[model samples]
Target: MNVHITLAHPEPTSFNGSLTYRAETYFKRAGNNVTKTDLYASDFDPVERGAHYKDRSNKDVFIPLGEQRAAWKNGTTPEDVRSEIDNLRNADLVILQFPLWWHGPPAILKGWFDRTFPSGGVYTSRMRYDEGYFKGKRAMLSVTTGAPEEAFGPGARGGDPATMLWPLHYSLHYLGFEVLHPFLAHGVQGHGYSYEDHGKAECRLAQKLDSWEDRLAGVWNEAAQSFPGWPDWDHRGQPLS
Candidate 1:
């Protein structure tokens, strides 16, 4: 199967990078084709602005969605966004690898969501949720945190992973991919930021990498996270059950 991995971390040698590398190796070793997009390395611009569109629907104002719709309709989408969308289209599985900064994904990755998923192209009023363009594909997040796993969850210092990741997961679900449970690596600090002995930190992180590999082996068979689809929502977009 074709697999696409998008890495959003800046440091190539960081643990976040390791998770991405490990995933690529795992998929490739299994004889699957792997495609990687290192957002930083490629210098992906995450900001949405009128600069990207030359023939604007309204030059006097910068309406992000309006320009996106026009671009999709006119085949004038920025080359980078078009390329990324094509990569997504050709993949069976997509892995989003990033570090949790300020309780969210990096700005670049967020921008990728903004630009790549074009209006009228990937989704329309009638093509969202269960009917999204990537309906048959799968997507998952490989996220790392500097705090210990114990520090997360309800009433925890680090905040609940579910709450932190809901927006991203929902966005993927919006695009029609089956969203898998995230592979979370907690206590993932650099040598300088580590609270424990450097050796102990290294040992723990290494183990997390092992766990990630094991998880990936069963990723395809793992059940997807539950989200409200079209059938589960009413005309007013309220949950039916």
Candidate 2:
């Protein structure tokens, strides 16, 4: 399978980076072609500018200002962002690897979505509220969190990690990607914890990669099950059942 892994953490030696490296290694070892997009290393621009839309044919093309404004407030769009979008368009699976910063993805990764997922980019405005681009793709999040898993449970340091992930889940699902259970590594900041520990965490991560490899190689049955019909709403907010 052709896979693309996008890493957003800045530190090369950080736990997030370590997981990305391991994931890439495992994917390749499984005989899959893997492409890596390190956001920070690539210096991806995160802000959107007027130029992106300045060339619109009509001054009143009915661009969704609310959505465009939201993206701009986050960051500027990178010049080479289209290449990343194209990668997603062609990939069999996409893995987003990042650190849990303030209970969300790092800004760079979020910016990636802002630019790559707008109308006329990946999904069109008419299809935004229905099934859209990326209709048959598969995606997963590989995250490293500094806090313990308990801290993210109900009524703890925050709420459930799954709750915090709703937007991400809905976004990918709306774009027609089959969502996989995330691979999360919690307690990275615990006492004596290190990315190179070569201990239980590493072993567990390896096991997770093995499972992920198997899943990626499997036929995309979930996509058909979730979207039994085309252009209709499924439980995941897209068309299927």
Best by lDDT: 1
For model 2, the stretches where C-alpha displacement exceeds 4 angstroms are 51-79, 126-130, 190-241
Query: Distance (Å) between predicted and true CA of 207, model 2?
Result: 7.5
Model 1, 1-241: lDDT tens digits are 9999999988898998888889999999999999999999999999999999989999998999999999999999999999999899999999999989999999999999988998899999989888989998999999988888889998889999999999999999999999999999888877313567788888888888899999999988999998988899889999897
- In model 1, the runs with Cα more than 4 Å from the true position are 191-193
Per residue, candidate 2 scores C-alpha lDDT tens digits across 161-228 of 88777677667777877777777777664332534465876666556556655555553444421323
lDDT of each: 0.91, 0.68
- RMSD (CA, Å), candidate 1 to true, equals 1.2
TM of each candidate vs. truth? 0.97, 0.73
Q: How many clashing residue pairs, candidate 1?
A: 0
Candidate 2 least-lDDT 10 residues: 220-229
lDDT of 2: 0.68
